[model samples]
Target chain A: MKLRDFVLRRIILAIPVIFGVLTITWFLSYVVGDPLAMYVTERTPDAAIPGIIRARGLDAPLVVQYFLYLTALFQGDWGVSTTTGADQPVLTVLARLFPATIELSIVAMSIAIVLGIPLGIISATRKDKAADHVTRVFALIGVSMPIFWFGLMLKYVLFYQLSVWDLPHLPGGDRYNFRAFGSWQPTTGFLLIDSLLFEHNPALFLDAVVHLIMPAFCLGYITLAIITRMMRSSMLEVIKEDYITLAKSKGLSERVVIYKHALRNALIPTVTVIGLAFGGLITGAVLTETIFNWPGLGRWATNSILNSDIAAINGFTLLVAFIFVIANFIVDMIYGVLDPRIRFG
Target chain B: MSDELVLHVKDLYVNFYTYEGIVKALDGVEMFLRRGDTMGVVGETGCGKSVTAKSILRLIEAPGRLDDGQILFFDQDFETKETIELDLAKLELEEMLEIRGNRISIVFQDPATYPNPVFRIGDQIAEVIELHQNLAMDVLYMKIAKLELTLSEATSDENRAEIEGKISYYRQQLDDPPEPDKKSMREAAKLKAIEMLRLVRMPAPEQVVNQYPHELSGGMRQRALIAMSLACNPSILICDEATTALDVTVQAQVLLLLNQLKAEIGTSIIVITHDMGVVAETCNWVNVMYAGTTVESCATEEIFAKPLHPYTAGLLIAVPKLHEVKDRLPQIRGTVPNLITPPTGCRFHPRCDYATSVCKEKKPLLEELEPGHWVACHHPLRS
Candidate 1:
C-alpha cells in the first residue's frame, strides 16, 4: 500500500478506539451517581435539582443521554464542570490546564529520550564493564523507586539540604515566583515559552527552567530508566545481528557500523517505548505535579476526582485515551519506517 | 591461479567466555588462501568454520576473544608495488578496518539477516564503494560524461590531437577528482551500486537498486550480498556458509555465481561449509576442520581419493553416495565434543574409531604426511 493510504487507514482506525474510550468513560461516570449531588445541601430546594438535571440532559434515558453526549462532544461542547470549576465548560478548563501538562511532559520526555537512549547505548556497547554496571544500577533505582518518594528525596537533598548547607539552593516546589511575575500575562500558558517569546523576559524564562528541573527529573526518571533498559537490550540484540557483522566486514568505521547500521534498527523498539511513555508522562504527572505544586491537568484532575466531578473526570479520561491512541498511531508509523518488513495493507 | 599466497592463518585460537564455561571455538585453526583459489573449509556443525572466517577479519566480538594466532595477509600496496605482510590478529580494530572490507570481505549465511533490513540494496552497496574508493561520484560522473562526449564528437581526423588532449584531461580528472559533495557522493555511489548489481547479474539493475533487501528473492538477496562483498574487489572473499541457507536450486545458482565472480574479479575465495558436495563442486583445495581444529588439509581430489585422518575418512564415508545403497548411510560414532572442556588431547579422539591410548593422551600436531597433504591424526589409515 502507498504511504498515504497506510497513514489514512491508521487515522481511520483510531476513530473506533477513541469512541470505545469515550463510551467506557461515559458508562463508568454513569455508575458513579449524579454529578450534581455535591451542589445539593439541606437548604437546597427539590425543585432546583430537576432543573439542573434537565438543563444538563441528565433526566433523559441512558441511550438518549449517550447520543446527546456524543453529539455535544462532536460539537466541541464537553459539558460544564460540575464541582471543580463550577459552571465553566469542561473543554475550556481542560484547554487552560492542558498546555502546562504538555509543556512539563515535553520537558520530561526530552530528558528521558536524550539521556535514556545514549545511556542505554553506552551500557549495551560496554556490556558488563563499569559503565554498563553503573547505568544498570541507575536504571534499577529509577524503575524501582516510587515517583513520590523520589520527588520528595530530590526536594530534600537538592532543596532542603542545600539550604541547610548554605549552598545555592533550588526552589523546592511550584512553577516560578508568581510575586515577581504577577503583572506578566501568559500568551501560550507555557511560562517558559511565554516568558521568552511574548514577555521577552530572560530572567522569567530562567526562573521557570529552574523550577522545572526537579519536577521534570522526578517525573522523567522512571521513563528514562525504562527507555535505557529497552534501548540497551535492543542495541545488544541488533549489534549481535549478522547485519552488524556484515557492516563491520565492510571496513566501515566503528562509529558508522554502530551508529548508522545498528543504531537505527535498535532504536525501533526504543521508539515504541518512547511514544507510549510520552502518553504515560502526560497522564502520570499527577504525583509529580501534586508534590511540586505545578498547576497542570494532573493536579486539576486530582481535585475533580476528589470532588466527584463526573464531567471533568470523563473529559480527562477521554483526552488521555486519545493521546494514547495518537501515540500508538505515531509509533506504528515509525515502525513502518524503521522496519521495511512491516508492509501496511 | 597465482602461486603467491594472499592470506596465511597459523595456529589460530579463539575462545568464547560464556556463563557456563569458556568455549574454545577455534583452536589452532590453520589454513591458507592463494591469490586466486576457491578454498573450502568443510566441517560439521559447531566445528568453528564461521569462527575461522571471522578471525581473518578480526571481527570477533567480546566474550569471543582471539586467544592466539597469526593471520599473515600479503597485502599489495598499489602505489609502491610492494607486498606488505600484516598480522590481522595482532592489528588493532581501527587498523584492521582498512583491510577488513577493502582487502578482505565476507558474505555470511542468512542473506535476509545479513544486509541491514532498513537500508536500500543500492545504498548499502554504494556505501562500501564510497568508503574504499574515495572518489567523488558527481565529479566522476561529469568526467565520464565529458570523455564520452569527446569520443562521440570525434568525427574529423584533423582535430584528433585536440580531442586526445581533452580526453586525457578528463581521464585524469576521473582518476583523481576533488572531494565530493555529500549529495553527489551518494549519487556517484548509487551509480556505482547499479554497476555492481549488474556485475552480479541481478535482473533489472535499475529497479533492484531502488528496492530494499526484503523486496528481493532469496537468490537475489544472496546475489545482492555478493555484489556488496565484491563491490571493492577485495583480494580475499570469504563465504561463511553463503549458499547453505538457500534452497537446492538457488544454492546451485549462487555457487555457480561465486565461481564465475571469482574468476572475473580475481578474488581468492574461501568457502566455509559443512557440505562435502559443495567442496567437490567449487573448491580446488579443501581444509577439513574437526571440532575447532584442522584435521586435514589437501587438494580437494586428494582428500576425497585418499582420506588421511580417521575423522576425515569418517566424514567422507558419511556422505550418501548415489550408486551405493545401504540400510543406514554410514554415520560417525559420537557427537561433537563440548569445546568448554573438550577431550584431553585431540578433540576428535573420543569420536574417532581409530582412537588408542596415545590418541587419548596427547594432542597431535598437523603433520605433512604426504605431498601437499596435511593431517593431525596420531594414527593414519594406510589405505
Candidate 2:
C-alpha cells in the first residue's frame, strides 16, 4: 500500500474508536447520576433545579439526550463546563488550558528522551561495568520513587532548603508569578512561548522555564527510567545478533557498530515505549500539575472529576482517547521508517 | 597455491568466562592458510571451527577472550608496500581495524541473520567497501561537476555522447573513493557494490542492491554476503560454515561459487564446516578438529585415502557410503568430551576406541607422520 493511503486509512479508522470512547464515557456518566447535584445546595430553591435541568436538555429521553450530545459534539459545541470553568464552554476551557499541558509534556518528553536513550546506550554497551551499575541504580530510583513525593523532595531541597541557606533557589509552584509580570497577554496560551514572543521579556521567559524544571523532571522521571531500561535490554539483545558481529567484522569503528547499526535496531522497541509514555504523560499529569500548582488540563480534569461534571469528563475522556490513537499512529509511522520490512508491507 | 602463508595461527587458545564455568572454546588451535589456497577446517559442532575463524580477525566478543596465541598475518604495508608480519592477537584494536575487512574478511554461517535486515543489501556491501577504500571525494565531486558543465555546454549529439562516456568512467572511479564525507562515498560505494553483486552472479544486481536481506532467498542472501566480504578484495576470506544453513542444492551452488570466486579473486579461502562432502568437493587442504583442538591437517585426498588419527578415521567412518549398505551406519563410540574439563591428555581419548594408557595420560603433539600431513595422535590408525 502507498504511504499516503496507509496514513489516511489509519486516520479514518480512528473515527469509530473515538466514537466508541464517547459512548462509553456517556454510559459511565449516566450510571454516576445527575451532574446537577453538585450545583445544588441547601440555599437553592426547588423550582430552579427543574429549570436548570431542562435548560441543559437533561429532561429529554435517554435516547434523545444521547443523540443530542453526539450532534452537539460534531457541531463544535462541547457542552458548558458545570463547576470547573462555570458556564464556559468545555471546548474553550480545554483549548485555553491545552497549550500548557502540551508545553509541559513536550518539555518532559524532551528530558526523558535526551537523558533516557543515551543512558540506555551507555548501560548496555558497558553492561556489568560501573557505568551500567550506576545507570541501573538511577533507573531503579526513578521507577520506584513516587512522582508527588519526588516533586515535594525537589521543592524541599532546591527551593525551601536553598532559600533558607541564602542560596539560589527555584520557585516552589505555579507556571509563573502573575504578580511580578502583571499578567501579560497570552498570545500562544503557552506562557513560556508567549512570555518571550509577545511581552518581549527575557525574565518572564526564564521564570517560566525555571518554574517548569521541577514539574517536568518529576513527570518525566518514570518515563526516562522506563525508556532507559527498555533501551538497555533492547540494545543488549541487538548487539548479540549476528549482524552486529558482521558489522564489527566489516572493520566499522565500535562507535559506528553500536550507534549506526545496533542502535537503530535496538530503538525499535524503545520508540514504542516512548510513544505510549508520551500519551500517558499528557493525560496523566494530574498529580504533577496539582503539586506544582501549574494551570494545565490535568488540574482542570481533576476538578471536573471531583465536581462530577459529566460533560467535561466525557470531553476529557474523548480527548485522551484521541491523543492515544494519534500517538500510536505516529509510532507506527516511525516503525515503517525504521524497519524496511514494515515499510514495504 | 603459493608457499607463503597468508595467515598462520599458532597455539591459539580462547576461553569463555561464563557464570557456569570457563568454557575452553579453542584449545591450542593451530592452522595456516596459504596464499590462494582453499583450506577446509572440518569439525563437529562446538569443536571451535567458528572460534578459530573469528580469532583470525580478533572478532571474539567479551566473555570470550583470546587467552593465548599468535595469529600472524603476512601482508604488505599500504603506503610502504613492504612485506610485514603482525601478530593479530597482540595488535591494538585500532591496528586490528586496519586488517579487518580490508586485508581479511569473513562471511558468517546464517545468511538470514548476518546481513542487517534494516539496511539495503547494496548499502551494507557499500559500507564495507567504503570502510577500506580511500577514494578522494573532492575529485569525484569535481568530476561530476565537470561532466554536468560539459553536458550543459555541448550542442552536438556526438559531443554529448563522448562526455557521457567520460562521465561514467569518472563515476566508476567514484566507487573507489575514500573518507568520512558520507554522501559521495556512499554513492561511490553503492556503484562498487553493484559491481560486486554482479561479480557474485546475483541476478538483477541493480535491484538486489536496493532490496533488504529479508527480501532475498537464502542463497541470494548468502551470495550478497559473499559479495560484501569480497568487496574490499581482502587477501583472506573466511567462510564460517557459509553453506551449512542452505538447501542441499543451494549449498552445492554456493560451494561452487566460492571455488570460482577464490580462483577469480585470488583470495585465500577458509571453508569451515563439518560436512565431509563439502571438504571432498571444495577444499584443497583439510584441517580436522576434535574437542577444541586440531586432530589432523593434510591434503583433502591424503586425509580421505589414508585416514590417520583415530578421531579422523572415526569421523570418516561415520559418513555413510552409497555403495555399502548396513542396518545402522558406523558411529563414533562416544560423544565429544566436555571442554571445561576435557579428557586430561588427548581430549578425544574418552571418545576414541583405540585409546590406551599413553593416549589417556599424555597429550599428543601435532607431528608430521608424512610430508605435508600432520596428525595429533598417540596411535595413528594408518601410521
Candidate 3:
C-alpha cells in the first residue's frame, strides 16, 4: 500500500474513536444516574415538572439531545452546573478544575515515571536477588492497597498522627482554600501556579508546594507502583529478545542496551497503561481530593451526587468523559512520539 | 586476514529458570564467524539455535541466565582491542549497549514483529543513529530523510529535515547534546541510512525508509530491517531464523539479499535457522544442533555429502528433496526431550538408530575428526 494512503487511513480511523468517546459520555449521563428522578425531586410540582423537564431539554429525543450536546461541545459550551449555584458552564468548571487536576495528575505521573521505571528496571535486572525481591514486595503492597485507603492513611499520618502538617483548619465540604494563602491569586487556578504567580514570599510557595505534595503523592503512589511493575515485565520480556542479544554482541554497555534498545521497545505497552491511568487521573481525584479537601472534580461530583443535583451530575459526568477521551487521544499522539509505530488510530 | 575471526562463541550454555525447573535452552554449543563468513546454525523449534545467538551479548532475561560461555569480538577496526573474551554471565548494564545493535546487530524472523507499534519507522531507525553515530547534524537529518524518502513517497526531504531537526531541537532544549554543529550530523546519518537502504535493493529506497512496518509489505519490512542492521556496519550480523516467517519465495529473496550484503559489505553473519535449504544456500559453515548441543559441524558441501552423525543423516533422509518425493517420507520418531532434566547420556540416544549401551551411559565429546569437520557422537556413521 502507498505510505500516504496508510496514514490517511489511520486519521480516518481516529474520527470514530473521538466520536465513540462523545457517544459514551452521552449514554453514561442517561444510565449512570436518574437525571429525571433528580430533576423532579427538586421541583416536583406536577405542573412545574414538565416545564422543568422541557426547560432542561430532557424531553428531547435521545439522538437530538446527543446531537445538541455534541454541537454545544464544539461551541465550547459544556452546559451549566445547576447544583453548585456555581451555575458555571461545564467547560468553565473543567477549565477551573482541569489545571488543578492536571497539575496534581502530572505531579503524580512524574513521581510514577521517575520512581517506577527505575524500580522496575532494577527489579527486573536483579531478578531473584534481595533487591529485586524487595522491589517486588513493595510493588505488591502498592498494588494490593487501594488508593482511597492510602489517601486516608496519609492524611491521618501527616495531618493528625505525626502533626507534621498543621492545617489550621480543613476546608469543610468544598475545595476553596479560605486559609491565609499569602498573596496568592488564581493565575492558573492551580496552587503551584497561583503560588508562583501571585505570592512574592517564598513561604507561600513552599506552603502551596507542601499542600500539593500530600494529595499528589497519595494519588500518584499507586500509579507509580503499577507503572514500575508494568515497565519491569515489559523490559524483562524485551531484554530477552534476540535483538537485545544482538545489541550486547556489539560490545555496547549493558546500560546502553537496556535503556536504548530494551526499555524503548518495552515502553510501547507501558504507554497504553499510562494513558488509561492518566485518563483516570484527569477525571479528578475522587478519594485523594476528598481526603485532602482539594475541591477537585472528584469531591465536587461526590457532593453533587449526594445533593442530587442533576446539572452538576450530568455536567461532571460529561466532563469526566471529556477528560478520559482527551487523555486517550493525547496518549495516542504520545505513542507515536515515543515509539513511532503507533498511528493516530 | 582470512583467519581473522570476527566473533567466537565458545562452549555456550543458556538456561531459563522457570517455576518447573531450569530450562536448559542452549547447552555446550560452540561456533565462530570469520570477517566475511555467513554461518548457519540449523535445528528444530526447541533446539536452542536462537538462544545460542542471543547468548552472544547476554541478552537473556530472568529467569534466563548465561550459565557458561565466552563471546570474543575483534573490535580492532574501531580502535578498541584485537581479542576481547566477553563473559556471558556478567556485564555492566551500560557497557552492554555498545555491543548490542551498535557493533553486532540482529534481525528477527518475524518482520512484522520487529517494529514497536507505538513508534514511527523513522524514529526507531533514528534512535539507533542517536546511540551509535557522531555524525554531523545536517548529515544525520539527511540520512533519516533519505531513509524515509525511500519507504514513503510523501515523506519529502523537507518534511524529514523538519521532523529530524525538530527532534534535535527538542533534544537540545533538554540539554541532552553538546552544542549544535553547522552541518547537522542528523542529515549525514540520514544519507548514510539511505545509502544502506538502497544497497539492500529496496525499491523506492527513499519511500520505504519513511514507511512504517505495517505500511510496507512483509518482504519490504524485512528488507528495511536488513537495512537497519547494516546501518552501523557491525562486525557480526545475527539473523535469528530471519526468513522463517516469510514465504518460500520471499525467504529466498531475503536469503539472496543476505548473501549479497555479506559479499559486498564483508559482514560476518550468524544465521540461526531451522531450514536446511537456507543453510545450504547462504552459509559457508553449517552447525547441526540437537538438544542444545552442536551434534555435527562441517562445511556446507562436505556436511551434505558426508554427514557423519546419525542424527544429521536422519535429518537429510526425513526431508523430501527436490530430486525425489517418497510415498512415505522418512520420519524421525520421538519428540524433543524435556530440557528440565535433559537426558543423562547422549541426548539423541533414544531417537538414534545407531544408539548402543555406551551411547546411553556416556555423553560423546565434540572432536575434530578432520581439519574443519567436528562431530559429537559415540559412534559416527561415516562411510
Candidate 4:
C-alpha cells in the first residue's frame, strides 16, 4: 500500500474503536451513580423527583438515551455541564483542555525520546563496559523514584524556599501578579513567549525557559529512563542477527549499522513501552500534576471527581478514552511500518 | 590460480571465552577462495562453516579470540597484494570497513531475515547505490535510468525544475501524490531492485518490489536476498547455507540461479552448506570441515574420485547417493564433539574409523596427496 493510504486506512479503523469507547462511557455514566439525582433532583423534594426526571428526559428508555446521545453528537452538542450551570459545551471544554494536556504529554515524551533513544544506542553499543553500567545505574535510580515526590522535591528545592533563581510561579496553573513584572509585561497564555513579548528580547524567554528546566525535566526523566532501558535491550537482540552481521560486513559505519539497520528493526518492541510512557503523560501523572499545581488533564480529572461533577468526569473520561484509542491506533500503524508482516484493512 | 587467489586463510583459530573454559570454534583452519570460482564449503552442524564465513569479514565479537589468519582482497595490485590474510589483529576498523561489503558481500540463509523489515526494499538497494556510485546528480540519474532502459522527459531542465518542485513537496509529504507523482528517486531504486529480482529469475519481479518480506514465499525471499547481495556486484559473494532451508526442488532452482549469477558476474562464491549433493552439483572446488578445522580441500572431481582423509571418506560414505541405493546408509559414529572444550589433538579422532594412537596424538595439517588434492589424515600417504 502507498504510505498515505496506509495512514488513512488506520484512521478509518480507529472510528469504530472511538465509537465503542464513547458508547461505553455513556453506559457507565448511568450505571455508576444516579445521574438523575446528581444532575437534577438530589436537592429537589422527593415528590418533585419524578417531575424533574420527566422534565429533563431521564425518564426515557435506555436505548432512547443512547440514540439521543448519538443524535446530540451529530448536532454538534456534547451535552452540558450539569454542575456549574456554566453553559459550557463538552467540546468546548475538551478543545480548551486538550492542548494543555497534549503540551504536557509532548513535554514528558520529549524527555523520554531525547534521553531514551541515545541512552539506548550508547548502552547497547558499550554492552558490558563502564558506560553501560553507569546508564543502568542512573536508569534504575530514575525508575525507582516516585514522580510526584520527585516533582514536589524539585519544586521545593528549586522554586519555593531558598529561591534558587525563583522560577516564575507555574505558568497558567499558578497565576503570578502582573504588577510584579514592574517595568516589563508581556501578553500570551504561554509564559515563555509572553515574558519575551514585552521587550522583544530572549533574556525573559530564557528566564521562563530556565524555569521550565526543572519541572519539564522532572516530568520527562523517569519515562526517559524506562524507554532507554527498553530500547537498549531490544537493540542488543537485533544486533546479534546474521543480517546485522551482513550489514556490518557491508562496511557500514558501526553507528550506521546499529541505528539504521539494527535499531530501526529493534524499535518494534520498544515502541510499546514508549507508548505506555506517553499514555502515562496524557492521563496525567496525578502526583506530578498535583505537586506542580499544573492545571492539566490530570488535575482537571481530579477536581471533577472531588466536586462530584458527572458532566466533567464523563467528559474527562471520554477525552482520555479518545487519546488512548488514537495513541493505540498510531502505535498499530507504526507496527505495520516497522514489521510489514502485519496487514489490516 | 595466482591471479584468482583473492582470499587465503592460514591456521585461523577462533576461541570464545566462556565460564567453563575457552570454546575453540575454529582451530587452525586453512581455507582459500579464488576469484571467479564457486567454492562450496560443506560440513555437518557445529562444524564451523559459519565461523569460517564470519572470519572473512572479521565479524566475530569479543570473547571470541581470533587466535590467527589472513584474508586478502582484490586491491589495486591485483597480484600478491590482493591476497590479504584473514588476520583480525592486523587490520583496523577503517581497513575492515573498506573490505567488508565493498569487496565481499554475504547472502545469508533466510532472505526475509536479511533486509531490515522496516525499510522499503527500494530504500535498502538505493542506499548501497548511493554509497558506492559517487556520481553527479544528472549523470547518476542517467546511469540508473539507463539500467531500466528508459530515460524520462522529466530529466529535461524545464521538466527537472517541475520535478524538483514536486520532490520538495514529496519531502514535505503534503498530501498523497498521484501515481505519476511517485518519487522517481525511490522508483529508480525500486526499478533496480526489481531488475535484480528478475535477474535471479523470480517471477513477477514488479509484483514483489513493494511487498514486504513476509509477502514473498521463502524461495522468493531467498531470491530477493540474492538480489540484495548482488546489489554491489560484489567481487566475492558468501552464501552461508544459502539453500539449506529450501526443499529439494527449490534448492536446485536456487543453486542454478547462484551458478548463473556466478557465471554472469564473474564473482567468486563461497557456498556454505551441509548438503554434499549440492556441493557435488554446484561447486567446482570443495572444502570439508570437521569440528572447526578443514580436514580436506581439493578439486571436486579429484576428491570425489580419490577421497583421502578418514573424516572426508567417512562423510562421503555416510550418505547414500541417489544412483547408488543401499540397504543401510553408512553412518559416521559419534556426534560432533562439544565446542566449549573440544577433544584435544585431532577433534574428529573419536568418530574416525582410522583413529590409531598416532591419529589421536596429533592433529594433521592438509598435505598434498595428489595434484590439487589436500587431505588432513595420518593415512593420506596410504591413499
Which candidate gets the maximum DockQ versus the true structure?
Answer: 2
> Would you list the C-alpha lDDT of every candidate in the order shown?
0.89, 0.89, 0.74, 0.73
Model 4, span A1-345: residue lDDT tens:
576787787788778877887788778767776776455434667888778688767889999978988888779777766443465776776665565456556766887788888898899999999999999998988899988777777677656654546654434223222354444442434555556665676765565455455556777888889888998998898898866876776678887888788987888888888776677777655566666565456666676666566667767777776677677777877877677666453
Give residue B67's error in model 1 in angstroms. Answer: 2.1
lDDT of 1 by residue, A222-291 (tens): 9999999999999999998989889999999978988999999999989989988989998889999998
Candidate 1's error at B190, in angstroms? 1.7
Model 2 lDDT, full chain set: 0.89
Taking the tens digit of each residue's C-alpha lDDT, what string does model 2 give over B129-211? 87788647654876688788989999999999999998887787776764446776677788889999999999999999999
User: How much is B141 displaced in model 2, in angstroms?
Assistant: 10
lDDT of 4 by residue, B190-301 (tens): 6677777788888888777776666778898788778877876777899999888888899899999899888887788999998888889989899999999999999888
Measured against the true structure, the TM-scores of the candidates, in listed sequence, are: 0.93, 0.95, 0.74, 0.83
What is the Cα-based lDDT of residue B28 in candidate 2?
92
| Per-candidate total of colliding backbone pairs | 0, 3, 79, 9
Root-mean-square deviation per candidate: 3.5, 2.9, 8.0, 6.7
Better of 2 and 4 by DockQ: 2
Sort by DockQ, best first: what order? 2, 1, 4, 3
Candidate 3: segments with Cα more than 4 A from true spot: A1-152, A164-188, A198-202, A222-252, A262-290, A295-303, A339-341, B1-17, B23-27, B30-38, B68-105, B116-183, B232-235, B323-325, B368-372
- Model 3 per-residue lDDT tens digits across residues B1-383: 28777777778888899999999887788776777788889888889987777677566667788888776676655575556655434666666666677778888788776655444455456557656876544453454556455445545678667666655554454433444463465545555666777888888877766666678888887887787787788878899988999998999999999988887877889999877888888888888999998898888998888999998888888878888857888878898899999887899999988999999899898889878889999999863
lDDT, candidate 4, residue A106?
A: 72
Distance from true position, residue B255, model 3, in Å? 2.7
